[model samples]
Target: MIPLPAGRTAPRTAPVTAPATAPAGRPAPGSVPPQRTASGRPAPGAEPGRDLFVDVLRLLGMALVVLQHWSMPVLSFGDGRIATGNALAAGNMWLVTWVSQVMPLIFFAGGAAGAISFGRAARRGLPAPAWVAARLRRLVLPVVPLAAVWLPLPHLLLAMGLPEQPVLTAARLAGQLLWFLAVYVAVVALTPLLVRLDAAYGLRVPAAMAAGAVVVDLVRFAGGLEAAGYLNIAFVWPAIHQLGLRYATGRPRRPWLIALAGYGAAAALVAAGPYPGSMIGMPGAAVSNMAPPTLALLAVGAGQIGLALALRPCAMAFARLPAVSRVLAWTGPRMMTVYLWHMSALCVVTAMVVVGLGISTPEPGGPAWLAGWPHWLLLLVLALWPLLRAFSRFEMPRPAAPYTGGTVRIAVAAGLAAAGLLLFTAFGFVPGPAPLAGAGLLLSALLLGRTAGPARRNAVPAPGTRR
Candidate 1:
């Protein structure tokens, strides 16, 4: 034993450790939260845990999404109504969109997360349906707060004598991002099967999907079947997601080389082919690659996937920094909360600037708006943090453990979530009979009979752990 210093206690002969307990049987697909370790340290050699690279990629995709929404026209008040449109359509910024339009990478990261989650669940004897139910719960829980606020909010605004058009437009923007949520859920539902296909078919699965997308685009353009273009919603993104599936299976053998080639190919197509260079939709553009997800979008998505993989090492290294790691660790679990509330924050800040403060909206393409954007973005971020802290808990609740019946029930939930999100995306959250119906469906899916209130303590998610 070592001698004690002045005013210090002597060390114990042995360091006390947490008593090891036998692993329990697989949870019966309940809505249980994560349990903390008794020793105040994560399990030793926990199975690989979450891949920091994937988390970093998710954060990047989320940041790009935030920036895209932030930069859109806050309030185009000159037309006698509160209107909004993409500000990126202005000036020489078309090239900048090439980098900003990284939505496909979101699905890419999602695919990786899905693959990892499914694999763990399968190992733990968790049934496929329950795993999916849990997965959808994570996605759906965050939307709960947003929907709770917005479902009745539009009606309140209309009753308060707000102008119809401005209210409607704001309603529209509020739910537009739900389109991504709907599509991403579709991709997640397919993950279990996609992983199996990847295991069996190797690279051919992606090749077939890519080829299918191109053929669909041709029919859409040549045969004048604009409806066929919508089919790419199913085709194009899943095709891009396949790239992620391949990556999950240890792919992009030479990520650097692939990134260069893919990017060069996409650029060439946009410059010379039928595709426009802009990755996102733009006003008055005859052929927006994004709207229909043309082959050009796929080309760009391929490039982005390659770029992400190539940068994985760097991103991982940066994420490990002491300060950066602490920030990320704090915010990681609350990411969906930030995303859900940001647009609401934008709406609030926009009104404060335009309506409350009497500052008119700058012209979309003018120099004044451009000069003021950085300042406006800064204000938005500052105003949003408090809202995020207040609302983030809704994203993860301390509800009684949740469980589902069978595959049929899980499928129904997914269908409801997708349909509800689609309605919000296409029609917006207008205070109308039909819109209210959609909101009802959304609420039902989120509630899913969540009888228990959320606990203030955060749920711990560990490696190969179920949340």
Candidate 2:
């Protein structure tokens, strides 16, 4: 959820080479302020100091997500493709459980980024609808290409006489990754309201909200009322959402203190047995607090955020290096694309290994055969880089503008997408030829609408700005 800056470049970290001393009263060499634009703004490619920190955090978050997915073990596969069941054994569950809370961390960071992006757009006098449109375009655009490429691959394999279970297994796993986009879209739509909440009640409101979510979860757990626990999906996650808004506004006097409280609460809940000690333990435990996230999870997120803040100094230092900065700059723009496609890339690699290399599946809970997993993972990572490069362009944000003539076109596209989803539901459609074809049509319509440009004259860039 790192918001791509409207026009800013990544920070540079090339070391300054200068003499030890300057002539009397002269400014120290390489100490002069970076040059500014003709309009007194930092030059187009110059990174803003505050934004550098945001990018670093974003990079870290993405890395954690990648690692979590990589470490996840696959269990049973339908059609030998899509993952169907938990691969975790009792022993390994404890080790991998903490990864459950990672998504919440990602969303919290996203909420913060969204607040900043929308706040800035508002200041430029961008209308709410326009801002929403632009955000949706950036979020939704890359998904099209990913779905297009991946949806049919499994079916093609099946047609080529590949086993049914393996093909279906891979397709299902790929589809699950789309959940991020669905959740993120919902969160982004709420950004404006959350920002307003921050402006009015400050951090206290979100803190209180989080507490309430926790209480609701605890009561539900104690009473054995499963439906009640679902409330947490809305409450606890949104509470974190509001916290992100608070971070964007920069109003808290002691963020560290708030974060500590969250950590303490999380520890107490886990100890109390309201939730599992491992955030993502093996499937079929008597109590799976995470199935319906408990207060404990929220506590963990708060603690993590505090921890992130604690490392701000180190993150800033790392972000200032030129090579590191450039990589972040390049990757940040394609964050969503990478996220959506990484699992697909892994699936491709796995297929190649099993079919092309004749490798047998490793024993469920034993060491992966020959310790070859590291090599496999490395290859997957390498393959993903070039794949992402080719596809990231679809994900880049379009310049902002007003909607005009394309309203009907956009509506038709949305209608088609809705229809396709309904059809899939009724027919039990798998990710194969028909679904992929539908996706292509929907994506084409979306792209055309986005590229058609702002529909009206007032859609021009705001005075003295480049949003």
Candidate 3:
């Protein structure tokens, strides 16, 4: 969700080096002066100043996601292979997913951030296709470094006499995280249209989407057609995304009321309907609120949006503190980097502890686990630090000549990129033609993004290299 500047080559920490406010006559670097409508309110998408609330929410949600992923796994090694279980699968532990499943918040933040970004682009006379292309490039570039390392890793491990199952497990888990990026690409591509829909219909847009989600849930549960549930991917997430669009216009008048209504509906669904209580999928659970995204999850998402809005003042206040601001500045640009590579870091630590040292995870909620949790967390941070340092640069690539192509070609390019991400998510980087094909599609997308207007020097630099 970080809005990386184009062609930025400054040190990674350069983003927040300046004071938040500038002298009387001069605006601070990267600060947008507010543009207001006739009502004396900031214009939609033209709200001046950094959205401290959105930044904090995105960072906190991502951090919690990383912690949850790292802590949930209970690994056991035997017979030259590894088996994995979820610590959260234990009795009554599902309650925690209500708060820990933060994707709704992430999508909300993305919607607000995308509004601001596209607003700025429109004001600068940039077309929608150009803006979409730029965002697509940013999304795809980071994945290149991931693919470069992971595509050949399983083969090397197998050649090194490592067991196939363990190696495949590690590789697949690493790639599975790309599912977010795939869904996000589709959302980004459609934002220009979605924002316009928001302007025209207000809450009705999301209301209609929510109604569609409920009907899809009926088809999924009542008719026993599980495949029908996936249709909510269109209805549910964009509905949440629409709420974010509404937020961009103004803060909710009574967020606590919104929160009460949302959570109340979610609770009703779980208690009286077939929906499961957990927002995330649990091992061995007959119903998962997350994978196919039930109406229960949408209700919880609405509640999360309201809860976050209610806390915005306090969160924004804390985000402005000198210490917190510095952390946000450094971490903001690397949010996507951290999201993409955190699982890889987990893979590394898992290998070292479970496969190498022969240490298996302790029992969930047991005395040993309570005692060892801090040590486990420390190891993960240690493993992730070097990765953050190494791959963070890909977050900003030098600019390509603005994709000067018409909308159709841009759509094609974005489609190819999404397809590539889906390939990685579905087939994984397990040694074979799938990873190679994914890499090719990504490269082809980049190549296709160039314009025929000027002499093309392979417009985009290779993903991880400096020009």
Candidate 4:
């Protein structure tokens, strides 16, 4: 077992080492947060205390999300319209519900990583503003190009006189994905406060938040306003965020057990019909299990986190292989890019299958032929991998040196983002079509301005850094 660092009262634990020649740019087992310093370099190797299992958790969660979307079958209403009434829609909803919580797991993992990364940044004297900025850059950068690519797609369809509702639905879906970015950005912004809470009171803060979330759910389920459920976004997600902090600090004696209880409780809720069994969507159901996030979803997130942790050993073992390591190393850097591009890839594939291939209707339920569908799915997955790989560069910061800008830039950017959201909601600004051409334009501009050239110059590693 390795000796624990000073100020870390957690028990000593076995070290998880990296391969002898782990990819050059990868952070060490533990290093200072990857954020850039005033000198525009990442802090040198800070601590060798990272858990490879956590990395695998993030990777697996995203992969599951991709699979879930890929397996989804397109459905249409009786009049050849795409709506919620299609027969196959129910099964699709069920499948999505089963796996929807995977994303919450990803959030938990991210929270934990954020906690650890922030601590490392503080140790190296990186200021709070710089830390926040770095994180925002990483999150927003990859989204820029993706938004740009799709900005004109809807307009093209509308110009061709496509049906209004379908065009609107696709545009809405694009915007829905952006919700993750908004929520995640909010979480990252609150990291400093969350870290302080953890440093002072340990898990109690998060535990309270989680309890509050459940209470909120109970109220919402029992005659409270439906929109009240959205409150859990702040309460429950942050509570899970705290769990990530616990993982970073080594405070929990048995994190997995707590996670198990959460899982069981969630299962019970769904089984009892208080909440839907599927965490995704359900056809013919008035309310989606995910629309406002029930307490059961939180429980599922907890369970998923525990499961991921338990599988850490296997992930670490696999990551040790040279060939495996190479793939992991490459993908790890571009995880954000893969996530941003995957939905678009699905749209592309769906278009090819339906329009180009003259397959008017997607197979109902699973693939037309179960075994054969698996092979087709595999091919689709492989086909998308290269495209995802090519897009990875958009996610990485530029290699140039840092440039100075102050609060003005930030304020302006924030104002634009808010204004953009307002316009989108008020006018039903379609991200794709010509009439709503500027729907995502502001967001695109902000993202590009912050990601390209000088913005990227700040991403270099600090002197003497080993990770």
Provide the overall lDDT of each model, using Cα atoms, as 2-decimal numbers.
0.66, 0.59, 0.78, 0.57
Candidates 2 and 3, the one with greater lDDT: 3
For every candidate, C-alpha RMSD to the true structure in Å:
10.1, 7.8, 7.0, 7.9
Runs in model 2 deviating more than 4 A are 1-46, 74-100, 251-256, 286-290, 355-371, 397-400, 404-467
Give Cα distance to truth, residue 392, candidate 3, Å: 1.0
Per-residue error (Å), model 2, residue 344: 0.6
* Worst lDDT 10-window in candidate 1: 1-10
TM-score against native, each model: 0.83, 0.76, 0.88, 0.76
Error of 4 at 17 (Å): 22
Compare candidates 1 and 2 on lDDT and give the better one: 1
TM-score, model 2 to reference: 0.76
Tens digits of lDDT, candidate 2, 1-467: 33232322211111111122446754333222333456875543344323555667667777777766665555333334444234454464554545444766676667666666665556556655555556656666666676666566766887899877766666666656554454465556566666666677777777787778867776787777777886776666777777766665453446588678867887677777757776653456766656566777777777777777666668767766657756865676777767777777777776776545656546545677338567767987987888888888776644555534344454454444444433332322265466655565556545644534544555655211245
lDDT by residue (94-200, candidate 3, tens digit) is: 88888888898888887776766666566546678877877887888888899999998898999999878889999999888787787788888898888788878
Candidate 1 per-residue lDDT over residues 1-467, each given as its tens digit: 00000000011111111111224743222111122246754332111233556666777877887888788664645443665566777777778776778777877766666665666556546566666756676677667667667778878888988666766767777888777788877777677778778778867987888888878877887787877877888878887777766665454677777677768878887777678878888777888888768877887788788887788778866765556556555566677777777888888887678755667668765799879888999999998999888886655544334344666666777788888878878877776665666767767765553323442244322222224
* Reference-based TM-score, model 4: 0.76
- Clashes (candidate 2): 19
State the displacement of the C-alpha of residue 226, model 1, in Å, after optimal TM-score superposition.
1.4
- Estimate the TM-score for candidate 1: 0.83
